[model samples]
Target: MRRKSIQNWRRSNSPVLKRFCASIGKSLGLPNQVADYWDTMLGGKSSSTDYFENYLLSEIDSPIVIGLDHVEVIFQYPEIASNFFCLLRTWNEKAKYGNSLSQVWEKLRLVVVYLTEVYMPLMIHHSSFNVGLSIGLPEFSRNQVQDLVQRYGFNWDSDQIKQLMSLVGGHPYLLQTALYHIWQQDFLLEELLAKYTINVRIYSEYLSEQLSNLRQYPELYAAFTQVTNSPTPVELEWEQALQLQTMGLVHVRGDRVLPSCNLYRQYFNVSASHLQEFHPKSGRAEG
Candidate 1:
C-alpha cells in the first residue's frame, strides 16, 4: 500500500506546541477546524495528543509517516521537548494493544531526524527516542570517498585522493564541497590542499559558523581547543566529548577524543593562537 508522508516539520519554525500541532494538522490535510481546535485548547499537552489520536483513527485511512526534521531545535525548550516526545511515545505504545484501535495507531509512523544527541533529561519509558531503532551515520570510508570522487567525473589517482582525505578526512560534506570547487573552478588538487586552512575562501563561511557555534559555550569551546591542539587524542569530560562529537567537531573513541578533521585542527589552532595573543592572561576566548 502507498504510504502518505509529511516530508518535514522543522521544529525551529514552530517551537510552540499549538503551532507545532497546527503544522502537523495542515500536513495531514486536516481542515481549519483542527487548527482552530488546537489554538482553542491552548496547546494543552494531553489535549494535543488525544486530538491526533482521534483524528488519525477517524480521518486518516492510509499509513502516514510524519517526519520531524531539525529536532535539535526543540532541545533548547526542554519542557516542550520533553512533553512532545513523551506524547509520541504514548502514541507508539497505543499501537501495540492488539485491538482495532491498535490498527489505527499503527498506521501512524514517525521519522525524527536531528544532528545532535538529546542532552536534555528524559524519562526512559516516556522518550520516543529510547524506544526507536537508532542509526548513526559515520564518516565515509576510503572506498566510498573514491566512489564519490569518480562520480564527480574526476580521474584522480589514489595518491591525490589520499592527499585530499589527509586534509579533510572522510567528511562527506567537506569532501564533496572540495571536489565540486576543484572540478568547477579548475583548481589543481595540490594548489587547493596547499591553501586548505580555515581562512581558505572556499571553507571560510562554514568554518566561521562552526567557530561561532563553539564560542557560544565557553566550556565546550575550551574542551574542543584542547582536542584540536593535542597531536594525539585527549580524554575530556564525557558530556563535553559527546557534545563535540554531536557537533561534528571531534571524533570520540573509548575515553579519548580528537579533532574530526585536519581542517578543524588547523582552523581552531590558529583561532586559539589569536585568542592567546589578544587575551594573554586567560589564554581563552570569551563567549
Candidate 2:
C-alpha cells in the first residue's frame, strides 16, 4: 500500500514501472499478468511517461476522470513536471484529433488542479489546454454563507453576518474556518476580528506557506506587494494575475487585481511591511 501511493510513485528515484505495475495489478486483480509484462518492458528504454500513456490507452474501456489536486507540487520537479503535462496535453490532443489510440484515450479526461498555473513554467502548447473545459471555481456567495451559518446552528445576526462577509469576502475556506472556530471553541465574533490584528494565527500557517511560495518567486512576490500596498485594485502582468488567482489570494477583474478578501489584505500587509523592512530599496508602490 505504501508503494502504491501516487506521491511515493512520482517522488521515488527507484524504478517506478515495476512498482506501478504491481500496484495497479493488485487493484485490478491481475498482479501476475501485469508483473509478467512489466518484467519484459523494464528491459527496454521506453520513456515512463510514454509507457504510462500506452498503458492507459490499453486499459481504459469506459469514461474515467483522472483528477490531480495541488498539481503545483509537481512544478518543483521541472523535468517530471514538463513531461507529465506534455503527456497530458498529447493525450488530450489525441482525443481531439482522432488517432489510433483515440478510442481509449478519449475516454480519459484529465482534471488538473493547482494553486499556480503550472503551465507557465513548462511553456506548454496553448492548443493542449485551450480546447479543454477550464472551470474557475467562484468564492462562496452571501446565501451560501448564510446557509452554512444556519447549518452550523450559529445564531448570528444579520450585522454579524455582514461583518464576517466584509472581513473574509465570502471565501469558502476562511468563512468555514472562522465559523468552525466560532462555533466549536465558542470564540467571540468581535474578539476574533480584534485578535486577527494581533495574531492571525487562525490563518497564519496557511498564509506563511503562501508567503514562502511567493518568496521563491521574487517577481510574483513583487506583484503581490504592489497589490497589498494599494487601497484599490491594481493592474498587473497577466501571468502575475493568473498566479494570484490560482493561489486564491486575489480577485482579477478585467485588468485590475485586488486582494481576494480582507483576510488576505490584513495578513499580507504585515508580510509587505516585513519585506520592506528587510529590503526597503526593493519595495515599489505599484506593479
CA lDDT scores, all candidates in order: 0.72, 0.68
Specify the poorest-scoring 10-residue window by lDDT in model 2: 41-50
Model 1, 1-287: lDDT tens digits are 01111123333444355555666778777763444445443555666765676773458788888887776666655576677777777766676453556766777777777765333333432356676667868889999999999998889899988988888888887898889888886586888877754226788877887887777677888999999999999999988887788777888889999987888899899888998987888876576
TM-score of each: 0.80, 0.76
Residue pairs clashing, model 1: none
Evaluate model 2: give its lDDT: 0.68
Runs in model 1 with CA error above 4 Å? 1-15, 34-43, 96-100, 117-128, 197-199, 281-287
Give me the displacement of residue 220 in model 2, in angstroms. Answer: 0.9
Best by lDDT: 1
**What 10-residue stretch in candidate 1 is worst by lDDT?**
1-10
